[model samples]
Target: MQKAYKRLMAATIVSFSFGLNHQVSAQSDTYQVVSTSYQKPITTFETYIGNKKIETVRYAFGNAQYINDGVMYGSETDRVVDLKNSKQTVKRLAPAPGQIRKYKDAYYVMSLEDMDHSSLTKYTLDFKKVGKTKKFTGYGRHLILIDNKAYVLADHMKGYNYSIKLHTFDTKSFATLHHETITSMLFAYHMRQVGSQLKIYGIRPEHEEKLTVLSYDVKKQRNVKTMTTNQYVKGGVEKTQTLTKETELIFNQDRMYEINHKTKQVRVLYDSKDDLVDYAYDAKTKTYHVLEEITKTAEFRVKTLNSHFKPIAEYRLKKSDSVSPFRVL
Candidate 1:
C-alpha cells in the first residue's frame, strides 16, 4: 500500500493469461487509473437544482423524476402544480409506462431498444399515427430534440460506433449526423460531460487495468479531445493506481449530466459514492463534491472541487450511507 502523485494500480477486476486475447492490451502508467479501494455497486443519485429544496428530486434507474419545466407525469393520477401561477393540474399516463422526464415544458421518455438490427421499439404516449421512427444501433437509447430536428444516437459498427443523430420528422431526410467513432490508441469508451472542459470519467470496458477518464465533451457534435486510459498489458492483467480524476467516480458508469446553456457546456455534477455529488446545486455554488469509496476497508472519502477543477478540500465520512440531501436553500 503506497501513495504517489501518480502510480500504477494493480487492476483488481480482471486477471487472466496475456497470451489469450490481445484486446485486453498492455498495462502501463500512460493511461489514468482509479484506486479500487472504493469499489461498490452504485445504484441511485439525487439532483438538487436552484436555491430551493422544493425544487429537488431523487433519481434512480426507472423512476420518473421532475424537472425545472414541470414535474414528471408518472401516474395516471399524478398531480402537477404550476409554481409561476400557483395553479395545479392532474395528469394521466397509460400503461404505467417508462421513466418520464419533463424539460422545457415537454414530457419525454427513454424508449430503450435491444439493437438486434431488424426492428425498433419506441416508447411514446401518442403512438397511434406515428410521425416517424429511426433505428439507432448503439448500446443504449439516446435521443434529444434541439431546434425542432429529432437527433437519435443510432446504428453503426458494433464496438466502434459513437452516436448517430437522425433528422427525424422529415420524410425525405435521413440520418443527418453520421456515426463519429472513437478512433485513437486509447480505444472506444462511453463518455459523458462531467464538467465544462474537464471531468469525463467512466468504467471503460476496453481498458483492462485502468479506468477511462476523458477531459472532453461527449455531447459535442464531435469529441473535443482524444485522451487515452492507463494501458493494461495485452490480455488479462491487474495493476493499481492513484485516485486521479479518472478514478474518482469509477463506480458511476451511468452518471447523469446536463448541458449548461449559459456557457454552452456540459457538466457531470453527480456520482454514486455520496449524496453530495448526487445532490442538487444552485447556479451560484460554483463548487462540486464527489465520493471515492474503499469498500475493501469499509472507509469512504469525500472530495470538494471548486468551479475551476481545484481540489479545495477532502472529508472523511463515517462508513455509512445515511448522508441526507444538503438543503442549502
Candidate 2:
C-alpha cells in the first residue's frame, strides 16, 4: 500500500511539471515596443495591455500619422509633431491632397487613386515642394523609396486578367529608369527592397500553394531568374528556397492571416467577429494591435499582442472624430 501511494504521487508530480512546462513554452517572448503614436483631430500617444488603457497622451493640434519606427513623427495639415521632444511646428508648404511619405531626407506626396494620371512630388525638409513633378503611368500603390528613387508595382486591367508592371523613377527628376511587365497576376502581395534589388512577392492565380518571389535588377532592366523562385508560370521553371521558418501576412476582406512558410499553416489573428473595428501590425515590435468596439459605450478598446499571439497590453479611448486607432503609414 505504501509503495503504491508513493508511485501515484510521483506520477502526479511529473504530470504537473509537464503542464507547467507546456504553459511556459507556449508563452510569447517579450516584445520590445519601439513606440506607438496615434491621433485624431488632436494627436495622442499611448501604451496598451489587452484592451486596457495604460497611458493616454494628447498633442496640441492636427490629425496624427503614426510611423512604426521608434522615432515619433506626426503630421497635420498645418503642422508636424515631434513626439520625443513634444514639439509641434507649423508646416511651411502648401496643403497636399494625397498622402505624404517621408523618405531619408525628403518627403513625397503622391495619389494612387488618380488612376487616369498621377505624379510624384518631392518636398524639402521644410515641406517645400522640390524639383519637377515625377510622373508615372497607371494606378500604382505600395510606394518603396530607396537609393534616391521611387519603386512601385502597378496594375492595369485587360479583357479577363490583369497585368502587373514595375515602374522606377528618379525621386528628384521623376525620370523613368526602368519600366516593364514582370508577370500578370490577380494582385500583388508584397513589394520591398532586398538589398540593392527590388523584390516583388506575390501569388499567381493558380499557384495559391506557393508564392513567387521575383527579384528585379533595375540596372539590368530584366528579371534575375536565379533569384526568382516558384515562378508559378505554367511553363516556367521553379527554384525552391529552403525556408526553415518564415512569416507572411495576408489581409482578406475582414481577416488577417499570419502564415507559416514551412508548414503552410495560416493562423487568423484578426477577424470581423466581436465588432473588431480595425487592426495594425508594428514590424519593429513584431506585435499585432487591434481595436475592438466597446459594447453600449462610446469608448473603444485597443489591444496589443506579441508575435506569438499572446496578449501584452490594452488601451481605451473615447470615440472621437478619428475612426482609426492606429495608422499604418
Candidate 3:
C-alpha cells in the first residue's frame, strides 16, 4: 500500500509539474520575467519584451519553488536569492520545503520530513527561525493566507483510504483555528482564493475522468459547495486560470475552457491541434498569451490574442538544445 501511494504521488507530481510549472517572477507593464527549466542543473530567468530577451539571470539551484517581490525561494537547497540585488542567502531551515507563504512581516514555510510527517515553520524577514507548528500527519500541498488566517491543504493516505485535511491558523498568534479531515477519493492539486471563498481543484483517485471543485467558506470555516464536471478533454483538466470573478479558464493539453462557478456552465475557449505548454493573461494590454508547440516543425511559439480570443500577434522562439519550458508571467 505504501508503494502504491508512492506511485500515485509520483504520477501526481509529474502531472502537476507539467500542468503548473513553478515559474515565479517579478513582472511589470514594460517587461515580463520568463523562467526556463532545462535538462541541466541550472535555472534561468529571462526578462523579455515580447520576443526580445533583455536580461538573463541564472541560478545554480534548479528547483525554485516560489518567487515573490524579487526573492526566489529554492525548495531542496533552501536557497533564497534577491534577483534585484544579485545576492544569495542560504538557510538550512526546512528539511524539504513544500510551500512558502509570506504574510505580513514574517514568512511561513511548510516542511515535509516524510510522507506522514509535515510541519509549519515561521521565519523572520531575514530568515531567522521564530517558531514552528506541531508535526502534521500528512503531506502539505499548499499554504494560503486569507485575511488574518493561514490555511493549509494536506493529503494523507492509509491502506486504500485517502483523506484531505484542512488546517487553519491565526496569523497573529499562530494558534490553531480549525482542523478538519475530509475522507474522499479526490486528490487535490491546486487551491486559489476567489472572492471570500477558497476554490480547491482536484480529480478522482480512481480515474482522471472527473474534475472536482470544492468551494470553502473561510468565515464559516466549512465547505460551502462542491461541483464535479467531466466535461474536460480526454486527458482531463491540466491547469486552471481565473478569467473573471465568476468564471475561470481550465486547460487540458489541447483545449481551454471557461467555466462559471455559480452556474457550472463551461464554454470552450481554444481547441488546438498542437500542444499548449503554458498561458497567461496581460491585464495592461488586455490580451491573452499562450505558448504552443508545433509538433511538425518541432518549434515553440507564443500566440497573443485579443480580449475576445482573436489572434493578434505571434512570436516564434528559437529552439535550444535543452528541454526548455517557458512560462509568461
Candidate 1 lDDT, tens digit per residue, 93-166?
Answer: 33332233332434443343344232122322332212344444443323344443333333344566443222
The residue ranges of model 1 lying beyond 4 angstroms of the native Cα positions read 1-62, 65-109, 114-130, 139-141, 144-177, 183-224, 229-277, 285-329
Q: lDDT by residue for model 2 over 1-329, one digit each (tens)? A: 99999999999999999787545533422222222224334555554443334566665545444342223344335344433354454453433323456788877765544544456777776667788776666665556778777877776665565678887788767888877886634556556665566766666655652445566776677787422233232212111211123655544334455545455455565454434544566666666666666656645665666766666565555566554454321
Worst 10 residues of 3 by lDDT: 21-30
lDDT agreement of model 1 with the native: 0.33
**Relative to the true structure, how large is the alpha-carbon lDDT of every model?**
0.33, 0.55, 0.71
User: lDDT of candidate 3 vs native?
Assistant: 0.71
Tell me, by TM-score, which candidate is best: 3
Each prediction's total of clashing residue pairs, residues at least 3 apart in sequence or on different chains, is 29, 10, 0
lDDT of 2: 0.55
